[model samples]
Target: MEIEVAIAGGHGKIGLLLGKLLVEQGHTVLGLIRNPDQEDDLHAIGVEPVLCDLEADDDVGEAVAGVDAVVFAAGAGAGSGVERKRTMDLGGAVKLIEAAREKGIGRYVIVSSMGAADPPAEGGDAFGEYLRAKAAADRALVESGLDYTIVRPGMLTDEPPTGRVEIGSRVERAEVPRADVAAVLAAVLVAPNTIGETFELISGETPIGDAVAAL
Candidate 1:
């Protein structure tokens, strides 16, 4: 089924890969980007670029209106401080959720971190703050009553996709390629069974499709 998908943080590594994959699959993809310079990048992959800053926008519903699904793939990025973690990671996700609800879009997917569910108590650094923010965002999505799937991937690498993964309610921490994470996110979008299912992702022997199907 061909559908329109709006991706927040569309210029991110995983988001760009996912957009290309979706476009190749005959789906219309809209990439919500904050930088005008990134428009051509999104267009190069056949994704329509919508300029909207997740942090500054009060109502993003207009940006996502008419899309069949929405994906929250934004982050505060590495080296970011605690405040950016709260505002961008958590706040950005909250904005997307509200926009999705306002537009009456049901399918919502978010890329989260592995330790979000149980962040370290002793660490008061940026990474710890990131986990807590993600946890809060996950909670909001779960309670939003939308058809949402939270994908918590392990340490992300830039390696090529393996096309195989291990997914479960909770899995051991390990490295998974950003390409493979994109593949898993694409699969989750099309799999109705994945709705309301939150799982940890990592490199495994199981094919991406089979792994998602088994979920």
Candidate 2:
């Protein structure tokens, strides 16, 4: 089934890759990006770009209005402060959730991080805050009553995709390429069984389709 998918943080590495894949699969993809300069990049991959800052936009319903599904892939980068973690990581997700609900869009997928379930102590550190933010966002999505899937990936690398992965409710910590993560996200969107399932992702011997199907 070809569906329209709206991806928040659409210019991010994984988002771009996912958009390209979706478009190649004959799905209409709308990439929500904060910077207008990134529009061409999205267009280059056949993803229509919607300019809207997740942090500043109070009402993002317009961005997701007619999409069949929504994906929250935004984050506060490594150099960001603690407050940005709260606002961007957590708050941005909240905004997207609210918008999805208001638009009556049921399918939602969030790209979360490992260790978000049990984050380290909040010692005024940025990384700790980021994990806590992801945890809170995950909680919100679970309780939102939407058809949601939370994918928590281990350390991300920029290497080429391996097309294989290990997915489970809990998995040992390891690294996976961003391309593989994007492949997993695309698979999850089309797999109805993945709805309401949250899992950890990492490099493994299992093919991506089989891994997601087994989920």
Candidate 3:
């Protein structure tokens, strides 16, 4: 089933890969980008680039308009301060959810961290701060009343696509390549049963298609 999908933060590392894969699969993709300069790259791959800052209140509603599903793939990268993390991670997700609700978007898929189910211990550093922000956003998504899939992934690596993965609810800490993560996102978009479910993803010997099916 071909669906029109909107990908927030689609200019970033994982987003770029997802845009390409979705396009290759014959799905209509709109790549929502905060950086205007990245628009050209996104357009080169058949993704309609819409300039909208999730932290800002403008152009976001129009960006998701007419789309069938939304993937919240945005994040605050390394070296950024905690405020940016909160705004971009948690606040940004909230804004998107609000906008999606207004737009009547039914399916929402969020990319979250593995240990986000539990709050980090005290004295948690920057990484912990990221996790907390994601956890908060995950909780918000659950309560949003939208069809949602929360993916808690372990360590994100830059390895090539392995075509294999491990997925289960309440799984312990594990690592998965970014390519595999993209595959999972694509699968969740098309899988009806994935809606309203949260799963932990990791790299394993199991085939990617089968792993998602088992989820």
* Residue-by-residue lDDT tens digits, candidate 3, 28-52: 9999887889989998989999888
- For candidate 2, write residues 17-83 as lDDT tens digits: 9999999999999999989999999989999999889899889999889999999988888889999
- Cα displacement (angstroms), candidate 1, residue 126, comes to 0.7
Indicate whether candidate 1 or candidate 3 has the larger lDDT. Answer: 1
lDDT of 2: 0.94
Residue 184 displacement (Å), model 1 = 0.6
Model 2 lowest lDDT segment of ten: 117-126
Candidate RMSDs in order: 0.9, 0.8, 1.3
- Residue pairs in clash, model 2: none
**Model 2, TM vs. native:** 0.98
Q: Candidate 3: give the clashing pairs.
A: none
lDDT of each: 0.94, 0.94, 0.89
Q: What's the true lDDT of residue 94 in model 3?
A: 87
Estimate candidate 3's alpha-carbon lDDT, on a 0 to 1 scale.
0.89
